[model samples]
Target: MADYTPNETGSQLFAEKMWLQGALITAVGYGAVLTLYVLAFYLLLSRLDRWNRQAHAIFLVYITVQFILATLFQASSARFTQLAFINNRDYPGGPGAYELAFFYIPVDMLGNIVYVLSNWFSDALLLWRCAVIYSTCRFPLWVIMGFPAVVMMGSVGSGIMYLLQVSTTSPFLPSSANFTIIDSSISLALNLMLTIMIVGRLVVYRFRLKTNFGLSVSQRDYTSVMAMLVESAGLYAAFSLFFIVPFALGSSVENIAFQALSQVQVIAPFLIIVRVSQGKAWSTSTALEITSASEGLGTLKDKVPMAQIQFACASGDDTSMPNAISHHPSVPNSDTTLTTEVV
Candidate 1:
């Protein structure tokens, strides 16, 4: 019940062919960029010891492998489709076309699986960041995180179902479109909620600090974190929406939108690494003296417990990070009490 025939007018056929080529080109281009980011990540980690480098190295390597697999699958699918169907119009209603309609190509199926897995991993990374930020909250943070976890599970289930359904039928099953739509909707909602929550918590924390110490809190601290959260989630949500619109409408551009979506996933994580590497430097304008013996020293020394700020898995150099007050070039301690100044 579907029209997969491209053997129409010369112009129509040319347009279809060009679209296919464009999708392949775009996917490959993103893969190239992903490779460069991975290379840079490795180079950046060279200074840290193996124990510190393990986490970052593992993350980059996993994503890089997925990118490679996605590229290969896309290329192979395009080649096989052309060789078996588009180029051989003599068999317009041939076995190749029929098989393609009734069943999934291994390459295409694998590519879809990889894309879904990529999204799952990316979402998990985002959730981890949110958890890191709110580790010391008095209220139950895990209880709040539970909502996204449920949504992501549903998304993964829907994605897998959609993949299976497409392979089993032509023009998709009656509810197949619903599965894809649900997946995209869930992804967008999850990312949006996570972004808002993270930013909101940071803003509230800043205000609390301000109230605790007579209005000495720096506005930039909270705002910078908010900006980072927006930048990280904005592109990903936008691309998910773009892909969903075309896909829900069954438009021809859905495939191309998917290619672009994959590219955005790669870009989001790459930006996170770059931002962390840049480091946030806060002003040292405030000084606190613990005792008169230490007065006039201009050295405001406070003991921030190691438990308060935990800068875990940050380029294997967590020990190099200074207190949250000074905003030095070092990584911030993860889940540790970062001793800062009230001055």
Candidate 2:
């Protein structure tokens, strides 16, 4: 038998409304999202064609591992926390599978190990991609890419040390000091460096784009492509604030905080995923706009297919002949490479 109600202050750390309403709601929500992530990652692994195959593979693995951790963490947290809230709770009352799983917290540490390492691994992929994208002439093959890899090695090295030494009882609970601050500090530092590197890469990319393609997005198609980047950046920034800010501010280890941050961490990558999936520009609207306006120079139109332009050529509001020579902007190449820079 076990105590169901929120107990001593130390145990209150596990306390959350988990019985009838709140627990059920959380269980359903987390379960649904986790399922979708699993399916999506699998499908992506199957269908990734030209996208950075190396980075995509790393991303898929990362997502898969995160999915597993999320599944286990959700199940354990829900049951343990709900048991905390249930009346007349029981733990070791079961003799079969439940007991076996409940007995192996040390083994479950491997899941946590996967969780953190996968995070840094995915970040390393992004950091190097950005370095390549930022490089003006040829992508930086060794130095810039290797720099992030070294940092990743450091992060992983510290993480393994902390995981091996830490003494956690559950996925939600922090282990000893090595696991808590030592591992956490290293993670935060690496992630912070990653964030800065991403910003720098984007800056370098914009500069390159400006220097390469001119600072002005004169064409309508270019404007549409820029919109996608802007939107994704906003999504990225929002998710970053959710996790990065909390880590920087030293928030408490309450289960609610843990759950909230856990969810944000889980969903953050999907934002990036959607952005990558939506590659290339030249939308229908851009085409329509270009169609509505004459193509050619303002004063004298090009001798190609151009948009309609009416003129008051003293013959009333006479419609100018659909100039056979006037040119309307044509979407250059449909297969244009829309750069999906990782960060």
Candidate 3:
């Protein structure tokens, strides 16, 4: 909001160092979490060998890219801080204005791009699962996803505009801040909507299963899966809010929270992979069984109740039914994707 000045008070330099310290702490935390993510990815591959390997691989790519973006941010921050402190007096001129301007690092542009891309990638992944869940129920896909999709585009546009403004301006502009604030707000809204819509579909689906099949498996197990999904989304949304609230309110924690936000973007999906692989949530085997059972019920809706259909199809022991199912046909790839939401 003001011109770049090298006349920094001791307190201001200390504050900047403190902000960078918080960012360093967040970076370390993310490093530990990224290790967990890699381990989880391996376990997922081993456990879901029979499932869609391509889809899982793609998801891993998203996480890896997010991690790479964070690493870039950390490197940029280190360079920026070094120029600010260690080389503060090395400029041949009286003082270095670019060095004093913390936001002018070229890496910052790349980092911002990465941050925005990672946020959207995670959001799109969740929305894809939502589409799969609702599609089975004959819900209109475009209608359900249309608004958030538009907002996502708006976020990207805003981010690009903000970067352009930052590149041209001597100091931070209110307009640039507005652009980022809008992007963060939209991102928060997208996450909240995804969490609510997905959790709602899951609860409804679980109820239908219980009503039709009558708790053959423990309700607790089923609930635990739903809870895990909800909690992961909730945690991500919570941090999105944490970053935005301080930022919007002009609170002191904004920088620290923003740094942490980058890592949480990776954490939410990685947690899903870990839970699924551990069988604390739905695994590939469980996902397949549910799909087969649901399809069998759809085909024999008039002849047998859902419970009987599941017994005939899922049990694998009915001699009277072909392959223990009255209507045992190969499930199409589209039909096989019902459990994509759980992960």
Using lDDT, give the best candidate's number. 3
TM-score (all chains, Cα) for each model:
0.63, 0.54, 0.68
C-alpha RMSD in Å of predicted model 3 compared with the true structure: 8.8
Instruction: Give each model's whole-structure lDDT.
Output: 0.56, 0.45, 0.62
In candidate 3 the C-alpha lDDT for residue 138 amounts to 57
Q: Per-residue lDDT for 290 in model 2?
A: 31
**In model 1, which regions exceed 4 Å deviation?**
1-25, 28-32, 73-103, 170-178, 202-222, 225-231, 277-343
Over the stretch 102-179, how does candidate 3's per-residue lDDT look in tens digits?
464576566666667777777776666556556655557798878867876776677676666556552223553556
Encode model 1's per-residue lDDT on 1-343: one tens digit a residue.
Answer: 9987645565445434544654675657576556657664665466346434665567557556655655655565565456545555455544234333534666556656666777877787677767665665667977877887887787778778767665655333355264566777788788877777776765664555445432222444324554545434666777777777876776556656666676676666555554443333111221121122123112222333334433334354566665453343343432122222212
> Which segments of model 3 are wrong by more than 4 Å?
1-18, 47-49, 89-100, 170-173, 207-222, 225-232, 275-343
Ten residues in sequence with the least summed lDDT for candidate 3: 334-343
Q: Model 1 lDDT vs. the true structure?
A: 0.56
**lDDT for predicted candidate 3 compared with the true structure:** 0.62
Top-down lDDT ranking: 3, 1, 2
lDDT of 3 at 212: 67
